[model samples]
Target: MRKDWQNLAPAHGLNALVENGTIENLEVKDHVANILETNGVDLNDVEGVIWSHWHFDHTGDPSTFPSSTKLIVGPGFSEVFTPGYPADKNGHCLESDFAGRELQEIDFSGSDVTIGRFKAFDYFRDGSFYILDAPGHTIGHINALARTNASPNPGFIHLGGDSVHHAAEIRPSEYLPLPESIEPSPVPKLHSNACPGHIFAPVLKDGSKTEHILEWQDPWAEFVEPKFGLIYNEKDLRETVRKDEELDANRDIFTFIAHDWSLKGVVDEFPKSLNGWKNKGWKETTRWLYLRDFQAAVV
Candidate 1:
């Protein structure tokens, strides 16, 4: 997977490629279809492909999937993104992608189910999986919360699709404050095996005191500022992120954003079950990994 991702990395670099969208890029060798095939899953077995939004990155080459596979999307999707590129010249998706597939749009207004201030739909109608109305990044942006385990103690995994660009945007909250020390050292060259939390005080947001790192402060300004800015609605995005933070605070819930690069080699890849993440201590080990990017500020 890493090799495939490396192949997709723009030769001109991400920023440059973004600036010049017309540049011919390398072919994406690692499509979901290929991955499923590698895992012994047949293309015809895929029931549906749930799109978080209409973004080019999230919406892969849907043409690769069998026509029997349904294409599911959030509310307001068909009104804007349907008929795709050639039919709607300004559209970001291609007509071939939805050619013979059933395009289903989710409507949350009819469902009274609420999960942490966001309207939710029970996909299975059994409370095991939920599709959350998490708009802000785009017109029909959505998220998923899956019940990983069920018993006296339940564990959930929140698939926060583009809710925030990075984990720091919603972390270091009052519930999960930065620890006094971070193990596996975010910056191994600067610290031994464990990095002291106070070393990061210099990079804290303005008006955030050194003590705030150890104990989260009200008005919560300890997170790193997001670098990218293509947010459709900043206000609504902030609210969505705030609600995500509430879920992240819970130890039983493992929440991850789509673009958290820090989790690359840390977690188990596809074909391997992530159900044992809690027992493996993945959350604790990966919590402060993003701080490595702030090493220069502290130095």
Candidate 2:
């Protein structure tokens, strides 16, 4: 989120989790600074802090904010957000102080809970600008969808939270570098001459199925390489199942993730905002140009 050196943690021993070249250490404050510069959105004005799950990068600088800020974390934020986590599994940065501010943990025990303005959040009604149910990344993993309502299609611009990392990961392209904790194997490109459509599901078809879209095993498929363990084998599967069931129940809601880098390109190509925020949603608009536009702007 914050693109500053100070925000990056010192590499001391994060080699266990990240691939080569990832920043190892950064401070809570430094990331806050980057958030301020890039998005121009005032952190002080952030009405709520919805941490999809408690990962270091996602929870970068939690303490910098005032305690009054309501923190929305998974039900098990306490258990997984601790020092023994795989990334911090070495017991190095396990100090509880890493969580800058006290958290208001929101547990979703397969039930609808009122968070903010929506009636039945997580899968009850049409989610507002900042919430969704996307578990699986963590036992308590979830997704948050935000929109300003100014766009012609507010339903189209959903913030997926961390359920997905980037757009390429979801698009018909090759798989991007996945986090080892989630997928342990390298993503294969199938075959050299294969079209991107080749990555879609249901490898075979017949008159039994019928039509241009024949027998799809998985419609929203991504070539996952679960690093922590197989999705069905892990102990966290129960929670994952509960969350997925809820998401499927309310599948009509349009949501997007919070940290997708490619989303800005889509945002830039088509920027819209709900009526609530002034100057459209560009309160912090500087860092959002398309890749070339951003490069040229800096040049």
Candidate 3:
């Protein structure tokens, strides 16, 4: 796009790429309706949709839905982003998404209900689902927590909207150690959770000027650097990660980083509730699967 490119929002940027033949045959889809139709579910009954934050990827094509369907977001969302796109010109969202719908922003500032370290609000008031105060990736970034099961031991599914990008972000730590063995699926099942080899990164001595600097190497795992770091608040983001990792450590909670592609074949998709995750052993089965991604990086 030239200087005259009026719309540069995430979706528009991507669409422009395709339209200009810079990218071809890319699938621009209405995934929301497709999933509902495939599952024999009615799309009209959708009361509303909750966006984890204001980022475009999470904020899908809400304009495709009926105007009666409300738009829900986390705290500070409206204050920071509203009167979207054409209305504000600098806005990243489309006004059509919330044009005639109710906008519900979850404000946990004065809430008394605290789940673990997060000030939480039960969306259903049934203690089964909650919106967590997650901040770091972006302002008003929030995560969801759902009680998966009840019985001898309760289980939870943590919907990490965008807190951690890679498994390495919260893995191989004191709480969750690398597995000695794993068994994946397909054919005889992807057994032997082995890697091509390990890579080591040298710990450079600080301010080393001479060749006499000596330091041992440490095993390296690269977690994709977070794009927007603490534009919201460093203290709040660090606190969020601290609590998030604690949740990752607990065996009862299965944290799903929304963008981790390694989970494609591991967990259940939409329309199908994730309530049986414990019985399915999803947390353990997909724990070491991320290593599959690094297989291609080896020479």
Candidate of highest lDDT: 1
Task: Show how many residue pairs clash in every candidate, following the order shown.
Answer: 0, 35, 1
lDDT of 2 at 79: 61
lDDT by residue for model 3 (67-179), tens = 87788888777876687777787666677668888998888977788777888988888888899988766777889888888757899888887776666556554555443
| Model 3, global lDDT | 0.65
176-285 per-residue lDDT for model 1 (tens digits):
67778889899999887998887877766552422123211222123312212246556777778778878887888888789888888988988998888888888888
lDDT of 2 by residue, 1-299 (tens): 33332323332233433445555453345555355546566666765667666445565544455655556666555564454323474332234334455555554455565433222254324444435444556545656544445345433234445554433223221111112121111122322221232222232122111112211122213443332222312434333333422332232333344554433533443223433333443312211111221222222
Task: State TM-scores per candidate.
Answer: 0.83, 0.48, 0.75
Ranking by lDDT: 1, 3, 2
On TM-score, the stronger of 1 and 2 is 1
Q: Which has the higher lDDT value, candidate number 1 or candidate number 2?
A: 1
* C-alpha RMSD of candidate 3: 7.9
Best by TM-score: 1
